[model samples]
Target: MKKYPFVYLACTAAVVGASLGATPASAGHMTHVVHAGQSIQKAVDAAESGDTVLITPGTYRESVTVTTPGLTLRGVGRGVVIEPAAAKAAGTCAAGGNGICVVGTKERKVEDVTLASLTVTGFTRSGVYATATDGLTVRHVTAVKNGVWGIAQEGSVRGVFRGNTARDNGDAGLFLANTISAEQGATDTGGTLVERNRLEGNRIGVTVRRLRNLTVTGNHLTGNCAGVFVVGDENKPRAGQVTVAENRIVRNNKSCPKTARLDALQGSGIVLTGTEDTLITQNVIRDNAGTSPLSGGIVLFKSFVGTASERNRISDNELSGNSPADLVDQETGKANTFEANTCQVSRPAGLC
Candidate 1:
């Protein structure tokens, strides 16, 4: 694991700034307008690279997929919605269908795709799911009330999911799973940023797994099972260099649920399980109470066999009034280090 010595905010902010500075392709590219009753899938299928599929205001009932590169699917205004195709209450796509699925693979990698200013809901699976796409951007969108995650990405690289609202999903609001099947080769996802978003009313707010060089900052998280989770122990071999900073994570009051996902940790601002090379700092973590004594502000726990959540740091945060304690640790997690954190109660209290 490469030690990310630079500040997370600076690095990601620079990248976001560079993206903002680049010229958008819509200026000279072809624009296809899809009316409310028209087929967005047809428009996307007909679109070429650097083309824009502009959706007008109204609710469309269908699942949209993007396979072309350098394409932008943007709503004209706030009222554009992609709801579950009412014909089949389960959705029109195959079982476990998402609202929008942007997919690619090593053989044919999609690049420079953007989805913006739209609302997607009522999918049986995630609202928006992207896999194996590079240079992906999801901004100013709303994903809500999906069967599972609001937005989910897997095996992706160099992505930005910012300025969005993700809430009321069955599972996590935003999920990043980076490990591909070993048969595909040992490629760990990298260079992703999740920032300036509102995540609430889900099982987990931001659920991260096995993504390297990720930065989560300037987000508001509340009313969820847990605010942020940096996971390891699935034994994929790489989950590192994650930074959670300058966010407000408070009052995530739900307990762990008994379901197919089998969530065992909840009611915490941040939970670190079998991770490494992470930094949590400059955030306000408080008022998260749950039924479990293990629920609290920051937890460093382990469940898997490798890496052991070591070389992680927590510093300069305001933590208080979480149920049980402000900081909790279990199962050989003393390898993590903390510095100058403002907390009154911590399990193994000497760390405070």
Candidate 2:
């Protein structure tokens, strides 16, 4: 397997603040610098809106919670690490077993918070978890060996997850859902972007559940049980209107047993269930071979909850050496089109 270095997009502090709708550093914004052996939470607590908490290179054994809007938490170098706390804390985030939490309320979203250039590992639940936030950017971070998710968000909009590495997580490496607590209609993410990330050795690379208006592009995913899963169920405004394009997905043959809600999964490049108007195009999927029911290069599977997928387009993708045929459409839905694909063999014939 080829490894890709983390791509760093350099920006001035002023430029980053402006993009997040925060006060510029030149305009009396404070930067609270914390050295090794110092408490990052102390600096974060002292920081006001638009202030920045800059962490130096060291391992921090504490869970960090950021509720202040427009606050920036950044590490100076790649050696910054955050692991599980030594003792249990009273904070909601630490109690919930997450490394970092950016939280807000339903009526008031924490806006424009940034987390960059750090490694969060060995958390019981998630590495970075966020909810009720807007314009949140997470970049160049590494999350590994988390029990549940690597980087997860729910009930948020306008999120940008770029240039990150998530590996060996128990669940999806990057998970975005409308809400995990209830069954509801899909929510619009207002063009959230998941791009240029490396995800491997997880149950799934990326899982977008009950979300719309997002794009998963330019990602490299391999050695997971499944690569990308766009999931929906029987609900109003069913999940759709998302794009999966220009990704490299290969050799995801790790087997995972059947869960309560899903069957066994392996060798799935991109799987769509109970979605409509989704576009799966221009991806390179190769050498994924398995015998699971969901195994294929690009599969349109029957929804577990009996919701049909309709009007989705699968086109112009490059696929080779995938088992159970390259393209498998088990559902007989309306107006789904497959055209102009480069592949050898497809289930039910003529799709390739």
Candidate 3:
């Protein structure tokens, strides 16, 4: 708990605008600055499109839900934290009990939401959760000690998550699940970029579920149960095209409890559970645990008989000193090409 210079105002004239008048969307950009002892939710609720909410450095113990588009929540510093309230003490936030939850319904189409320069923690599910938005940007944020993911996005499109630090959580530091649904439809159909983030000491560093055109690059993932796990299920087989390049994915051998999800899937750097057309290139995949048959620097495996991790290209990766082996491909994987990699490979895997 670092002390920041805060404006100790009981009630300042900085209340959000009273009545909304018709203003040009291009010209009317307002900013509502809230101090400590004030309600940030009030500022967000009263804010119109293209308005900005600036919160001063302070600790706020409440769950925030913002639904408007083009609304930005900018904190003065990372010292501005939002912890869980007593009401949010439930086991999970998937049913709407999150620290900072931003949602846009399918019929509403809220776009251009941003959450930047803030620290959110101590929630039941995720520290920050966003879903079904047209374009969402979460930048320079910190999420720690949360129940599930540090940042979790589902059914969101055009998301840019960068320069974030997520650690010591119940699940992955960052989790993105962009799948088709009856309510959300096809989201993130274009693509999503996850770059230059730090993930450590979690169940999984980063996890993707049925996403299309996902680029995961320039990330440092270490000391997690699994560094990166991309999977598609039996129902949705086409999990999308993924490119994992230029990442320092190493030493993801964090031990989990016997009751953990994928408990045997530990000590692996990257696991392609069931995705199609994946290109893993130019990555430093080294020093992973490789405890299980599936654990290694990289693994291409399938969950079921019919479903397979297909059409993958694993090339030009530096690997060494793994417990089990450098690379592994289960019998269910099909048509995966492994070539031109610099590493000590397992049996049946020869360098090109």
Candidate 4:
């Protein structure tokens, strides 16, 4: 009986050793090479868990969706292109197709994927949409000439948008909206970090609504309709706090003459309405020319909440050729503080 037990142990050890030797150390890191005549969706379909689909440099004229977790879709260099069929559609284009969408139920990540180093254009809706996903990172990417916003994120949490360039989009460069119903109120959709991005020539540079604990810093916003528009709903009990600091917001002077009543209503470098607990500090708000009256450097109007525009410690912030001074339209029910601001332009009373 003792001899039989020893033989069995030896046989089990040999079988385990053979299995380990046959497999590579990083067998989990499988690689799927995507080439010509292969659809990008097929490569994603063939990917197992924790696999990386390495796409070689080519023009791929198809829209892709990522539903798998821990799967990385990377381009060889910067020539990986996915052009849609039509210019604009909500989810997909009737003329062009849709762009890449990450619609994972669990948290997923998509990184190091370049969009338009070789001219991938013609999409409706957005170039990239990260909906109901978490930990999605879009870095070192360029999205240009899209139908709507360049990058749109809805119901996404803990996402990072860094080193991305968005230009000539139909709407805002980056549109982030948290439209959870009141019954599903305040679902902590992760804190969004937007930094070091070049957002220009869009309808709006960045539009944020119904979010919490957002930090937008070190970005360049120029030649858009509005630099940064922060809006919220008054009926909601939860107040979203935003920190806008150390950004260069200049020359968002697009005209809307037909909406002269609207233009004369609200316009500025940083436009805020119905938002609370916002910190607009250390930002260079300069040369935001308005098409009509009621425009200035940093304008806050009709905000029935509390904000602190102090210690923006604004200095050397050149406000030239703008009709009004640095701060304008100090209304009721909104508490704000303006301190240490240097403005060179001339304005009327109560606009300092």
Instruction: Please state every model's RMSD to the true fold in angstroms.
Output: 9.4, 7.1, 6.5, 10.1
Judge candidate 4 at residue 187 and give its lDDT. Answer: 31
Candidate 2 residue lDDT tens string, 233-328: 889889999999999999999999999999998899999999999999999999888899999999998788988899999999999999988998
Candidate 4 per-residue lDDT over residues 243-281, each given as its tens digit? 777888888776533342134332357766656667777
TM-score of 4: 0.76
lDDT of each: 0.79, 0.90, 0.77, 0.62
Q: Give residue 214's error in model 2 in angstroms.
A: 0.4
Q: What is the TM-score of each candidate against the true structure?
A: 0.86, 0.93, 0.86, 0.76
lDDT of 2 at 209: 98
Give residue 254's lDDT in candidate 3 (0 to 100).
Answer: 82
Candidate ordering by TM-score (highest first): 2, 1, 3, 4
What is the TM-score (0 to 1) of candidate 1? 0.86
| lDDT of model 4 at position 314 | 27
Q: List the residue pairs that clash in candidate 2.
A: none
lDDT of 1 by residue, 1-352 (tens): 6532211111111111322222233244666667678888878887788777777778999888898999888885458999978675333342457899888876877999999989999887899999889989999889999998999988888899999999899989999886434422123556688999999898899988776788999999999988998877645555768899999999998766665534455677898877877899999998987755448899887744533677889999999988778888764655578889999988877767
lDDT of 3 by residue, 195-224 (tens): 999999888899887777888999999988
